[model samples]
Each structure stands twice: as C-alpha cells, then as structure tokens.
Target: MKFDTTQLSQKTQTLSPYSRLPTPCSLLPLLKLYNKTISQIVKLWNH
Candidate 1:
C-alpha cells in the first residue's frame, strides 16, 4: 500500500545511469496507459 523511493531508485540503478534523463513526473496517466495496453494485449490473445 505504501510506495518506497529508496527501493525503486536502487532497483533502477541496475538498469541505467541516472544522469541521462529528468526526474520522475506525474505517473497517473502512464499507469492508465499501462493498464489499457495490458488489457488490450489480453483481449488480443483471447481473440
């Protein structure tokens, strides 16, 4: 239920260096897109 920034940053360090981009932004819409895409993919697979 609670989000942890330290854990997330540590996880992302394994993937890339931090200086390449801006910091985090509003993610509500990004999560919506992710949910939509997942459902769409599931529907495609079922069809």
Candidate 2:
C-alpha cells in the first residue's frame, strides 16, 4: 500500500474559527487531527 501525504494538503480545509471565534475551538480540532494521523501511521508501521 502507498500513502501520499501531499494529497492531504490538497484537500481544502476551512479556516475554521479564524476570525471572531473561540480559541480552543480552533486549536482542539487541529490537535485531534494530528493525533489521529499519528496513530494511524504508527499502526501501519507496527503491522
């Protein structure tokens, strides 16, 4: 199986609470996404 990380960037992501938005709302989402991605990669390598 092949993984293309560049593809992830190609997908458009909303600025998501950039202006006039709660701070945690913006940060938490990103932290979650990063954790999930890291877990997935770890699983793949472990297998």
Candidate 3:
C-alpha cells in the first residue's frame, strides 16, 4: 500500500508528451469534495 514514486514516473513517461496531467491546484478541489462526501456517508452510517 506504499506510494511508489518510481512506478508513477514510469507510467507518466509512457504517456504522450502533449498529454496533460492535473496539477495539485486542480486536484485540491476534487480532494476536498471527495472528503466532504465521505464524511457525510460516515455520518449516515453512524446514525
């Protein structure tokens, strides 16, 4: 379950140079929204 930087870099290298990846800035909102949804789900299960 460890995060593997080498594996990530290898995958990225296989992509076309013109392909775009989401920057951290773009990912932040998605991460926040995902967290909020998980929190709500936990609350419902706890209820």
Candidate 4:
C-alpha cells in the first residue's frame, strides 16, 4: 500500500489538540486546576 503524506499531515492537524486551541500552554494550568477541584470534591464527598 502507498502512503499519502498530504493526507497524513491533514489527519495529524485534525487530531492534534494544540492545533484546536489558541494557546497550548493554557491547557496545562486549566487541567491542573480541574484536577485539584475534582480531588477536593471527592474528599468532601468522602468526609
């Protein structure tokens, strides 16, 4: 089977989260905050 580079590049662009977001670095802080919130909620639920 022959591989198409153009098709592969397009697929990569579509699949990449960095391409969809305006700032890739922004996701890290938001993810950390979300995790902290989730853990705090779980702790409260457990108590």
- TM-score of candidate 4 on Cα atoms, chains taken together: 0.52
Q: Superposing every Cα of model 4 onto the true structure, what RMSD results?
A: 6.3
Tens-digit per-residue lDDT, 1-47, candidate 4: 89999999999999999767767587789989999999999999999
lDDT of 2 at 41: 100
> In model 3, which regions exceed 4 Å deviation?
1-18
Please tell me which predicted candidate would have the highest lDDT against the true structure.
Answer: 4
Q: lDDT, candidate 2, residue 8? A: 63
Of 2 and 4, the candidate ahead on lDDT is 4
| Superposed Cα deviation of residue 7, candidate 2 (Å) | 45
Ranking by TM-score: 3, 4, 2, 1
Model 4 scores a C-alpha lDDT of: 0.91
Model 1: per-residue Cα lDDT over 1-47, one tens digit each: 89999999877886676555554565677888999999999999999
Candidates' TM-scores?
Answer: 0.46, 0.48, 0.60, 0.52
Instruction: Please give, for residues 1-47, the per-residue lDDT of candidate 2 as tens digits.
Output: 79877766554234334444668877899999999999999999999
Model 2: weakest 10-residue lDDT segment is 11-20
Each model's C-alpha lDDT? 0.82, 0.76, 0.89, 0.91
Q: Provide the lDDT at 7 for model 4.
A: 100
Model 4 alpha-carbon drift over 4 Å, by segment: 1-20
Best-matching candidate per TM-score: 3
